[model samples]
Target: MIRHQRQNYDWGINAEGSSLEGGAAQVAMNGDTVFIHYICRDEDGNMVDDSAESEDHPVSFEVGAGEITGNPLFQAFDEAIRGLPLGSTTVLEARGGDWNRELFFEVPRDHAEIQRLEGRYKNQGGLQDGLIVELSNGGSAMVVAVTDDVVKIDANNMLAGKRRIFEVTLLNIEPAQR
Candidate 1:
């Protein structure tokens, strides 16, 4: 398990003579791609997700690039890690109710579209056209119903609609690939 520790540093002027405030010591800047490992838990203290289970689990995303914008938990994570230096570990809290309702509402509709496409596939077996799949962003979804021109899919994440706490560590930071 990764342990969390707090460190203090002097905020000195940068090479451009700009004053560094807050915890900006060797921090990630806009457009910087950061690699992080995180463990997330709900308010009840149940582990929802974690990247520290394996060395290969660290995830990378560009700061301020909207990669994690859709999820409120991730948005809080983005905010907490912004001014933190590399190799720093911090705990962040997020209220799931803070997520944009409209955005969450759209996910089901989008999943329905995916379900429709799955139903249209010719390789469906003798059973009804129902399949569960994992999304690229680590969510699981399943086709629950299908009709002539419509399909219903249920996609949900464990942390959705729950207050969450995240223990995150910034492992590395580099320039954005593009």
Candidate 2:
């Protein structure tokens, strides 16, 4: 009975080690796949976004080096949650730099799909009224307005006007299991 109990204790400790969340994460950066459920918020602690709390599809990334560059809203992930292990929940608040900047970006044709989903309506005719886009997490946005000549997708994120925060959990790490 004593031996069995010791074995169980070791197993529990090992399980904890497998869930550490600091260091260079072994994610799929080159054609690797990672499943994550996450949320976004402004610095003010207001709920700006939440995947677990949303109806939209969970954020899945290919885990590349620069795939997330367009969205400057990654300060939360870059700082505290970058090296987290799989299945770990990482809660991070957006830094001040992520806020206070209106990220004027040009929406490429490839990004048009998300643009349409975000209600990025083209300013056809003399429509001056802005459009509101709702994220899956019940966060509605007015930054992703579209124009006639180009899709003016605001990559600064909907919560750019305020600070940002995030709660991310690694649901799956495909490459590491293999």
Q: Which candidate has the highest TM-score of all?
A: 1
TM-score of model 2 vs. true structure: 0.45
Which residue ranges in model 1 land beyond 4 Å of their true spot? Answer: 1-24, 54-56, 67-70, 98-161, 175-178
Considering summed lDDT, which 10 consecutive residues are worst modelled in model 2?
Answer: 1-10
lDDT of 2 by residue, 1-178 (tens): 0111111111111011124434554543344556778766555667766787666556665555334574434433432333456666655444433443354544553464545553444444321325555444565544445465444434444444454546667777656333
lDDT for 121 in candidate 2 is 44
Error of 1 at 105 (Å): 14
Clashing pairs in 2: 42-163, 43-163, 43-164, 94-164
Each prediction's TM-score against the native? Answer: 0.49, 0.45
lDDT of 1 by residue, 20-125 (tens): 3455367876788889998877788999888877767778777876444675445555655666678777776654343333323223334654554454543755
Candidate 2 wrong stretches, greater than 4 Å: 1-31, 53-56, 65-69, 74-82, 95-161, 176-178
Cand. 1 Cα-lDDT: 0.58
User: For all the candidates, what are their Cα RMSDs to the real structure?
Assistant: 10.2, 12.9
Clashes of each: 0, 4
